[model samples]
Every structure is written in C-alpha cells, then in structure tokens.
Target: MTASDPSGPFRLLAQCPPGLEPTLTRELAALGIPAPHQTPMAGGVMWNGGWEQLLRANLHLRVASRVLVEVGSFRARALGELVRKGRVAVDWERIRAAAGGDGRRIVFRVSASRSRLYHEGAIEARLREAGELPDVAGVGEEAEPRTRDPGEAEEFPGVAGPGDRADAPGTPILVVVRVHRDQVTVRLDTSGAHLHQRGYRQHVGTAPMRETLAAGLLLQGPLEPDGGWSRPSLVDPFCGSGTIPIEAVLLARRIPAGMASVGFVPRDFACLHWPDLPPDVWEMEVARARAGIRPLDPERFAVFGSDRDARVIEAARANAKRAGVPEEVHLATAPLSKAPHPDDSGWIVTNPPFGTRLGARKSLRPLYAALGRSVQPGGRMVGWRLLYLSADPVLDHATGLPLEVRMTTRHGGLTVRAVAAR
Candidate 1:
C-alpha cells in the first residue's frame, strides 16, 4: 500500500486516434482500470487511477500512444492567479521525494482552443514558479527552459534556483496546461516518450512502422486476444524490418516494452523519487517479464516475413534474430503477390509499399490488385488503411471480393486504414 493509493485516486490521461478510442477504452477495461471518460478534444482521452493502475496501464496497454497523470484543473482568468493556484494544488514535497535525488525538472505544455485568456508564456512561467525551478546553468541563451531535449546536457543549464543542488534528490515534474474558455487544466506527465518505442527494435529499415501502430492494426484483425498466440502462426507479407511479427510475439509473451530500451523518460523522471517506489519493485517487474517469456513454437506460430527487396528481407531476418524471435520467424524473399500462404485461416497483415518515399508509384496498383487476389476468400488481408498513404484503393475494387474496413489509424504521419475479409 503506497501513499498515493491510500490518499485518493489519481487522474490519468491517455491519447489515441479518435476512431480507435473505443478499442483503447476496451483495452483499459480489460486491465481493470476505471472506465475512461472521452474528452471532446482531438487525440486525447481521460481516465482516473492510483499509482498501481498507472503502472499497469503503462505495462499492459497496447493502444495508448502516451499516458499522463492529472495534477490539477481550475479556472484562472489571469496568468498570476493561474501560477499561484497551480503551485498550491500540487504536493511539491511528495514529488521531490519521488524523483530519487534530482529536483523535479518541471516541463510545461499549453494548449488553448477558442479562449480569450490565451497566453502560453504566462502559463509556463507560473508552472516554473510552482515547481521550484531547478538551477540549470551553462545552457545557450536561445534555450527555452521547458522544451530542452533530455539528450542534451548542456541545454538543461544545471538547475533553475538555489534549492536545486547535485545532492538534492527530488521529483522531476512535467506540467501540461490546457486552457479552454478560461478553464485551465494542468496535468503532470507520468509516461515519458510515446509508449510505442517498446525498446526492442535495434535494427530499422528504410522506413519502419512503430510497435504501437502495428499492435493497433493487429487488434483490428481476426487474432483472438486471450493468449491466442500459444500456437500462433503469424505472417507479415510486407514485414519491413519485422516490426509487426516482433510486436505480436512480445504481446503474446507479455514482455514489457521497456525491457529492451536503454533509456526512457520515466527512468529520469521525478516520480521515481517517491520513497514508495522501492528498488525491489523494479526488480520484481523484471523478474515477472523474464518468467513470462516462453519459447515460441516454431511450427505453430510460424512467424514469417517477406519483401520484394532481398536486402530488406535480409534486414528483417537479422532484426528478428536480434529480437530473440529468429527461430520463430521464417524470413524469405518474395513479393506481396507471390508470398506463400501459411494456412487458409492464418492472419495475413502487411504494410505494402505506399510509394511515398520509394519510386514505386507505377507498381503500386498492380501490386495491390495482385495482393487482393492472393488472399483467397475466407482468408484475412489487412493493409495500410489511409487512402492517401497508399495508391491502391483499386485493389479492394479489383479483388472483386467483399471487403470490410475494420479500423482507421495513423502511422508515421500517414493515416492507415485496415481492411479484413472473412
């Protein structure tokens, strides 16, 4: 029982595509997190929970792009009052303790939609005063205190105030201020860096899809959720560096996304400064991840990747091996139209060349047409859903096969639309 859990429920905010909100909501429900309330804002969703629920959401959520903790929300007509109220609302002492030994690096983000009291700089100033600005020195003059990239040490400028010292351990806080019609809502970021990194992809091809996007696309498929991959036979006909199949294996095995990554924003955050987060808890997390990993059945799941470019296929094979799923994934050099069929009912998901970067515009239509024909009736075919992302809408029309649009999502700045036919 941590102090946060006993004090009261914590408010959490998660961001995802508008169309996929229902799916994300369902995902939260499965994890036992309180049902989230949908906000009218674009690309934002709200939920409430304590520290335990926050950790669970970070570990188990497959659809959320990022998870944030709500610190406070209030109405402030002017900048002065806003800062004063924000500082008083948050428990700075508790936050400082959670950050390990570093004073909380308070980050502020302001968003205003149709509001008269629209001043981003003012909101930021208030947040800094409230967070007890750490002393950051030697940074360049152009450096804005809040937007400093974590990778650049010189950019951080040491600490902001006299209280910030090397030996002083405190929580690093990120404050996001959203002002709509005089209403100011402030939130502290709990999950740093978009949740999609998942850490494992050491090798990237010319263009690689994010793990989160791949998972969302898979969720739109016919794959069962309840440990269905025990004997899973997954195939990505256009597997670029094997992201889809790799993510599938991770989810099937219940591996934590951060296990493979060296650094995450959460690791350097102030929340870990809290005394409640004992070192044993982190060790236990690692232990659970290790125990959950089971040897994948090469014959059953039979993960496979195919690409027209032999070099890309080679890269995918090497990447799968690096991710520890080499034996499970069978990489081969084949075009989408010529890829071998695993089983009549097997899942066939791919992100075919969209001809956006590669000079393959002339070949897209025919390639999509051939792909549609390849998936015989009663089999599944999922592809990038966005109309602009790919030049093959005719593929759906050409297959002369009945198709259903399952979900629409965004991947790497391109909107993706997933389709399936049973």
Candidate 2:
C-alpha cells in the first residue's frame, strides 16, 4: 500500500552512523522488528511498519540518529516536474487527517542531483510553492516563493528541540526531499531532533561521543535486560561525557531511550501533534514501551567510568544524574594510566582522542601504548576486554593490546575502527 493509504504500512528509515548498519539491523530485530532491510546507502536501515512501530522505534532505538517516515516519493526530471509530482503525490490529506483538522507549520527541505533539475534552490522553491497550492497547508498558487533563508532549524537540521527545549514552538513537520540521479524521495522527520540528543549531556567535553553511536557500541554484546546474563562488568576508561557508561545503564535498566523525548516527535510533528490524536493514542504507546522495562536491581552490574579531566568528570556525573542514570554509573577523574579497571574481568569500551589536531598525532602512539600497558594481563586492570576506536593504522598497531578490527565506521567525519582485545 502507498503512503497515502491512511491505515497502510509505510517504510521507516532508521538513520545511523556508517558501518553500524548491521548493528542497527540487529538492534531492530532484537526490538521485535524482524529482518530490517538495509538501504543502498550509508547510515540507513529500512523497515516496513505502522505508526506504532514508528513510535516504538523512536522510543527504543539507541543506534539510530533519527526516524524518517517515507511520506511520499516520485520520479522527477525537472524542477517543475518535482513541484507537480510533489503536489499530487504527497498525501497531504493523509497527514492532515493524522493531525485531525488541518493547517499546521509545514517546512519544505529539498535537494536535487543528476537529471536536469540539479539546482537545489529552484527545487526547494518548487516544492515550497507546491505546498501552498490551495489543497496543501501553507502557500497559495500565486503567492511569491519565500526568500532563501535557512533559519536555525535549517542551520542545525539534525538537532530538533530536545525534550522540553522549544526550538520550534509551532510544531512544524520537516520534509526532506532527496533527488538522487532523478528519483525524488520525500520523507518526513518523524523524529523532531536527532535521537542522539538523548535529553542529557547538556554539558559536553571537547569531543563528545554521540549517544546513538554509544548505544551501537554498547550493543557489542547482549549487555541488556534481555540477555540471559545478568550484568557483567562494563567500564569506559575514556569516558569523556560518560556516554558509553550512561547508555550501558540505560540498557541495563531497560529504560526507553526516548523517555524524555515523548513530546518531541509525535507531539511536535505538526501532523501528528498530541491534540490531533485520540486522548489515549500516544499514552498507550508510551505505556506499552514502559511496560517492556524489566526492572533490574540497581546493583546488577559493576558499571563505571573515568577521565583525566576533573571538570569533565564533574560534567559526566551531572549529566548522568540528569539522565536519571547517575546511580547506574560511578564516575571518577584519573589519567589514562590511572583509568579505572574492573576487579577481575570486565569490558572496557572507550573512544580516545583521535588526534585530529595538527601536532596531536605524535602523542597518540604513547597514549595508546600507555593504555595498552595499563590493561595488560598482569596489571590491576588485567583480563579486561578493551574496546577502543582507532583511525591511523600506525597508532592502532602502537596500542600493543591484542585488539582485532571487528568493524570500521565513520565518527565525526573520520574513519574509525572499533578494535576489541579480549
């Protein structure tokens, strides 16, 4: 069935960091979404489901950055063709119905490539013009196209208002138009903000790890409420903003990832705003997701982290407290050599500085070497399975720890490999 079919299933794209597509696919399967399909591109996994599944994904998925609903799509060879197709093919009525009555803040984001319509501006204007075409929501047929000005929303398109942060008060639906070659695919940002904005980490270190990637890394094992195993020791030696450890406790506690983002997407989605739905619509979904939480004893796992910077340790503690995971993590300040280690055997997941700065590359070797020496079998940190991110091959070799490259992924525009030494 098409997206226009009000009750029909539509495709949802769970966007993730590159190289974690398989990880995300597995996460979805574990969430009860069977056999998710990977797209022919980086950073996307496709699954067919209804609004319930869409909401569940936004609520539970830790590996995805955002969830995009395929609202409409069509083949367009020209800007005019895109406008014509966008106006007719887009099930505005469907969205309108979802929002109950009609008339809401609708934002059109468009891009074009290949084909004859290669101009992004013209394509955006065309789609914008189409939306105003009487039947849609905003503009009129004769109204002048808006001047090109991408406001803050466009400036940080990936970041929507987080939790209760009101970035956009009008509840606007973000429409993304991707014209690859000549195929125009239109999608709706079901998630207002990037899922990485997990309502925590208001204060971040210089290089903060994204929550989604942290969750993806956390998925390395079934370190969960579902994995027959109770909690094994989980540690993040380089816990800058405490993302890894925070996400670990979130999983161990079985807390929904989007617990605080309840009002962000569905309520702020313009078309799917709260007032538009039945009183118990979202409440039911929220309850269902919450019910899935299997409360674990707070003492189940020996999870903790440490950093060299005292200030960042304070920030990590505060952030964890705000995330409601403070009790789940033990944060400390120590040098890499003094990084915390499990008493016996434990998992060490961390993202050290990539040394992207000019002169910083020289220090990587010694840093990795020191870390290697610290976690070796004979030390207090002995028998610790270390998971770290590495970019330069020379530095990877310098670690001296027995780590195998299990996967290669991009982080902050750099190709970093996740190396694990068990």
Candidate 3:
C-alpha cells in the first residue's frame, strides 16, 4: 500500500479548544490555507495542508491544542467491515518508508460514542493488518525495556521507556478512529506532541500556565488579533516566571512558537515523504522573525512585571532573557497592588494565584481588594482592563470597582474570569 504519489501531500488535521477555533482559523487563513472545518469533538478542529503548512501551524498558532493529519476516513457498520476497511485504507509501504525501513509500529484509538459497534481488540487488529506490523501484546511487555539496566537507556534509541514518551523520536503512525452513530473517521496524528511544549520553560513556579494558553489569554485582552502587542503596554502583575510577558514578546516579534524548539512530533511524521522540505524555508522564517522583531526598548512601551517574591522576579528576568525579550520588559519586586505604573492607558493581565492552587482563601482577599484599587481612577485609568483568572466572585466586591465580567473559561482545572472596568 504505497502512497498514491510522493508529490501528493497528506491530509492534515489540527485540533484546538472549541473556544479557540475562530482564532486558529484566522491564523491559518493568514497563511493562505483554507479555513478549518469545525467538528463536534471537544477542543477539536480540522484543517488540510502539506509539510510546510503543518510546520507553520506548529510554529505560528497561538491557541491550537494539537495538530493531526488525516490518513484515511471510511464508513464501517460492523467489526468485520471495520477490519476490512481499515486494512485497505492504510498505505503500508508509505508507513514503512516513513519509518526509515524499520519494522513499523501502529497505535489504534477507537471512539464509539453513539454506535453499537464497540470492539477495541477488533479495531486494534484491523489497524495492525492495515499497517502490516506485529503487535507487541500487553503493556507490561513494553515496560520491560526500561528495567534492562540503567546503562541500557540509550540502547533502545528512539523507543521511549515508561515515563519518558515525550522524548521518544522516530515517527510511529498512529491511527485514530472515531465512530459517531454509523460513521468512522480515521486520522494519522502528524504532530506527535502538543505544539505548546516549546521546551523553553525550564524553570516554572506554582500553577505555571502553558505558553499557548498564556498567549491566548494575552490576545483576549488588549493585544491586536494580527499578532501585535505594541499598544496598551502589557503588564503581568503576578508574572510567574514571565510566561505571559515572554509570549508577548514572541507575538510582538512575529516569532513562531516553536522557532527555538529542536523537535516536534510532526518532524517524525511520515508526511515528509515528499521531496525534502524547501531548503530555505527555515532560514527564511528566521530572517522574517529577525526582521519583524520589535526593538526591546523598555521606555518605548511599558511591558512591566512584578511579583511579591523577589526570587520569582529573578526567575522572570532570567526567563525573559532566555526568550530574547529581556530588554523589552521591565521587572520589579512588589505586590500586585504596588506593581510599577506603566503609561496611563495600559492593560493589566495576570494569572493570580487562585485560592485552590495558592492555598488559604482568607489570606488573598486583601490582595485582590488592593489590586482593584491600584487599577482605579488615579492609578491606571477607566480604559484599563484587569483580566484575571479567579474562582471567587467576591473579588469584584473586594476590588470595590464596578467591573463587568466579560468572559470566563476553564484553565488548569480552574474557572477563570475576565473583568473589564471602563
């Protein structure tokens, strides 16, 4: 089952939170790719593209959860039909070639939400037949590779042992089959890992938000949709290791999320089966990033951050330097109420430590109240918006400001509310 033609690119599918579908679609549209077709799955969206577009999605998308490529889609009414259709749809030769001629491994994921055809083993067997690969039975058998010896860790090469699957290299073709009612849709996951794990946040503090999530939160605030962070001087009063500020700089410079990342799940995917990706693509991206990078002049626009703990402020400074936006940010050691004042009309966006994650609800009330006062009349302005994630509605009363709750969403298993005061 060789690929139809190496020239014909595979059908790529990218997934993200339902709330972010519109933002992701707009991002793809800017690259000249067609808008993604929406699906009912939670945090799922579908898009089509080749290797270059796939790379661009991984690098540029600020809100997508993960990107997957569609390998095949078929309708199967019964177990036998599933087996037959699944095996016939896979291109074994292409899978083997993508694996660099090694014995290929196939993973089958089945979802039978509203259908009677729910047989996991049969589906796995069908996928195995499709790829012409041997299934190493049982999870325990896979775990045996780790106990061979500490020195044998490197012997397995690309195979991941027990807890380290994130580091595993060499693409294994994954078959994801979702059966809704009587229809089965099978897709091959091209982006192996979620694109958010850019591998830069070596040091993280309590409840550190993901880079992608932080970027989305920022965009939802004062930042423009077209990747511009120039206006409304951004400030993260609770700057935990500076994830938000660092992401702001990346957005300002038009630097793709995964630009500094060395590995992506898509890199190992079989889709690169085409003539090697254009040699200058990467170089051109880098040059574009350099050209678009806004000079990090602290005085130009107020990108300020502050934290009560001096140690956390140190961490934020270090992380900002690593992100190549050290000069663009102003760091200070102070509580949220005392955070440095930027231009009169800037935005205050921070992920304050929630009572659940930070502990002791009673202790944080005073802090929230003070935060409200700091952003009021003489401090910032009527146009200044305080976008924060809080579980306590009492925070509005604590702030003593007549703020309108604009939007709310769940992040890190906590309810986040965005409030705007005009």
* Predicted structure with the largest TM-score when compared to the true one: 2
Candidate 2 TM-score, true structure as reference: 0.83
Cα lDDT tens digits, model 1, 1-422, are 53123243667777665556666766666555434343423555566556665665665566676666766777777767776786787656544553445344554556675676676665666656766766343122223444432221111223221112322433234445778887877766555445665545656778787666677766765343323542346677788788877767756655544443222112222233347755665555456546655656656566667777787777777766655566666778887656655652466676777765445655566766666656554424433221112324554565555667777666555555676654
- Candidate 3 local Cα displacement, residue 45, angstroms: 2.7
Runs in model 3 deviating more than 4 A are 1-9, 34-42, 92-94, 104-109, 119-122, 137-175, 260-292, 296-300, 357-359, 378-383, 394-397, 402-408
Error of 1 at 148 (Å): 16
Candidate 1 RMSD to the correct structure:
6.7
The candidates, ranked best first by lDDT, are: 2, 3, 1
Tell me the spans in candidate 2 whose CA falls farther than 4 Å from its real position: 1-7, 36-41, 94-105, 133-160, 165-172, 222-231, 260-279
TM for candidate 3 is 0.79
Candidate 2 residues 1-422, lDDT tens each? 22122243767787777777788777677666666243425667887766666766777777777778787878888777887788988766554543334444555666555767776556767776765522343332122233322211122232345554323444445566778878888787777766777777888998987887787666765264243333368778789988888888777766777763222232233224433344364677777766765555634566879998988899898888877766668889988777765565677788888897657888777987877776776665776677777777777778786678777776766777878775
- Per-residue CA lDDT of model 3 for 269-346, tens digit only, reads 233332344546545544654455445455545677888888877888777776656667788898765778665567
lDDT of 1: 0.57
List TM-scores for all candidates, in order. 0.76, 0.83, 0.79
- Stretches of model 1 off by over 4 angstroms after superposition: 1-8, 34-45, 94-105, 134-173, 224-226, 229-232, 260-275, 278-291, 356-362, 377-400
- Scanning candidate 2 in windows of ten residues, the lowest lDDT window is 148-157
